[model samples]
Target: MKQIIEKKRTLGLLLVILGASFWGIGGTVAQRLFQQDNIAVEWLVSSRLLLAGILLIALYKITHRQASIFVIWRTKQTAFRQILFSLLGMLAVQYTYMMSIAIGNSAVATLLQYLAPLFIMAYYLLTRHSALTRQDGIAVTLTLVGTFLLLTNGSFSTLSVPFMAVFWGILSGLSLAFYSIYAVPLLQQFHSLLVVGWSMLIGGTVMSFFHQPWLIDLSTWTFSTVLYYLFIIIFGTMLAFWFYIASLRYLSPKEASLLGSLEPLTAVITSVWWLKISFGGYQFMGTLLILLMILYLTVFQKKQRER
Candidate 1:
């Protein structure tokens, strides 16, 4: 029975990692589309969230065959908290990431974003929780090193880290950490889809106020642009979030954290294939180190459990 449970948990973690990998693909796609089309970043984010929220909500209703839409307005307190999480987690992180990219480069932005796990570890520590074990430390170190190499192009000194970019990236990381931590509690109280849907809706709605998506020139929407938007909404936001939440049901937070490191790796692969970006030998090695760290942590964790 214990073995069976462990197997199930492993499967769940795999699913979550797979979901995050798919989610990682969105950045490359977005960047490619953005370069080709004259689309504002704000508008792109706003549209993606709004469309994704609508689609997920619809999916939830169709699957359950119930009126979940009305649940959104059941209570002001619930509504407000949902919106708050959405803004802080989804909107804030997304916008901050974009801003970081603008201020620095994709590599820097990605490294900073991947630092969420570290921030999470720190959060736990601050709360008087046990510090991450050797495995966790190894995993975090490996990820950080991998991120640095991935971003620095193998020579840290060659790169000039922009202060603003770093700030935004750190902020993005914290936002994501907070989202993960806080979301766990919310998920316990509400269905994952419902919580996700409401959060997306609230986040999307708040972003719309600032982005004024209506101001976007509809004439700019081309066949390719529409396709790009569709991919972001469907694959990036909706499917990714769904899979991530599903994974949480079976995986420990530590396990999930380790798997989440794959995002940067996926991003790198996408960059190479989709974005036509290339890296040098050292850069590749750095990425490898990061992966190794994640593997070390995960395998060590399994070993510990067995003992």
Candidate 2:
């Protein structure tokens, strides 16, 4: 039984890492589309959310015909909470992260969003009044130093990007933090598919009023651009959510979110490897620091379980 549990958890962690990988790569691709094609951010966000939401919901309808997505919101209390989460957490995260990408580049946007774990840490401390462990303190310090190195590119005299990127990126981080913490109750009680699908649908529907994605013009887009857009919607948005949500079954929301540190590492590698962006020792060290923090958390959790 113990071995079986371990195997299941390993599977869950891999799925969450895969999901984060998609987000990282997808963000890079989306950044390319935005910069090269001048694609409208509002339209892309609205379309991605709606299309991904619909696809997941349709999948649920097919497999579990007995369980409607509406069952997630069967009670008034739940309905209200779900709507609030959809708007405040889901919608905000999607839009702000995309906006950060549009205003900046993927690596910076992604790294900034990793600040979500910090917010998660602060939240657990404040609400739970939990005392910090030695590992937590060291991890927090590493995360901060890693973030600073990334943004400054190891330089004290200059920032690597404009102020707008920093502003929007921090907002993206906050939104991500909120979603990771807030989605716990719903995720624990329902199928990950049901909760995520309905939340996406509701969030997309709300964003539609502000930006009518159907009115988008694709005349300037080529075959490759179209392919990238589809990939973002299907793989990055839809599959990513499904995998990450499913991981909640095996891991605490905070630990799962902490494991998401992999996304920025993925983004940085993609940026340098595929995009031919320049990189060097300092960035590598920063990446190492962040990875060490993740490693610390993983070991800490396992050790606690053993104890």
Candidate 3:
């Protein structure tokens, strides 16, 4: 039984890692479409949330015959809560991340999103929950230093990327922190996929009023861009959420969040390898430092749990 429990935890960690990695790769692909093809961010975000939500809900209905999607939001209070979740948590995170990508490269955008952990740390303290440990303090410092180095390439005078990328990226990080924290109770009660699906549906419906994706010129779409859209929706948005939520079954959101450090690393690697993005020695060091945060949590936390 003990070994079985450990096995489940291991699987959970691996799933979160895989999910984050997919997110990173998907961000790179989305960056390509935005940079090369000039695909509109609003359109993709609108379409992704709408379609992915529908598909996930459909999947839930198929697999869960006895379970109805409506039950999760049946009560007025829960419905209100879910609506807020959809707007502030779901829509905010998705839109901001995509906007960040549109303004900057995938590597920078994704790494900035990893800053969610720092926000989460502050949140925990303010809520008077688990206090930050020495290790957590180290993680925070490394993340800040790493982000500065990666963004500036050790230059204090000028910014390497557009200023809006930093703005949108930081907004994405805060939204992600909010989303992850808000998701816990819902995951504990309902099907994770169902919750995610409904939230996406709600958020997409709201954003569509403003973005109007249907009005966009689809005539400009080519085979490669279409393929990229499929990947962004299917692998990136759908499967990534499914796997990440499944991992929450065996881990806290904070633990899952920490594991998500894989995202920036994967993003950096793919951006450099396929996209020909350049990085300085300082940026490389910064990237390594960020990766060390992942190693620290994975190695050190396990021992803490065992003790």
* TM-scores for every predicted model: 0.90, 0.91, 0.89
Instruction: Give the clashing residue pairs of candidate 2, or none.
Output: none
RMSD of 1: 2.2
Best by lDDT: 3
- Tens digits of lDDT, candidate 3, 204-264: 8998999886887778889988898899898888877778877888877777877776676
User: Candidate 1 — worst ten consecutive residues by lDDT sum?
Assistant: 252-261
Each model's C-alpha lDDT? 0.75, 0.79, 0.81
lDDT of 1 by residue, 31-147 (tens): 776678866778877877787877877778888885566574588876677777788877787788878877787777887887788888888888967676776777777777877
What are the RMSD figures for all models against the true structure?
2.2, 2.2, 2.4
Q: Clashes in model 1: which pairs?
A: none
Considering every candidate listed, which one attains the maximal TM-score?
2
Between prediction 1 and prediction 2, which has the larger lDDT? 2
lDDT string for model 2 (33-77, tens) is: 888988889988888889898988899889998876778767987
Candidate 3: global Cα-lDDT? 0.81
Better of 2 and 3 by TM-score: 2
By TM-score, highest first, what's the ranking? Answer: 2, 1, 3
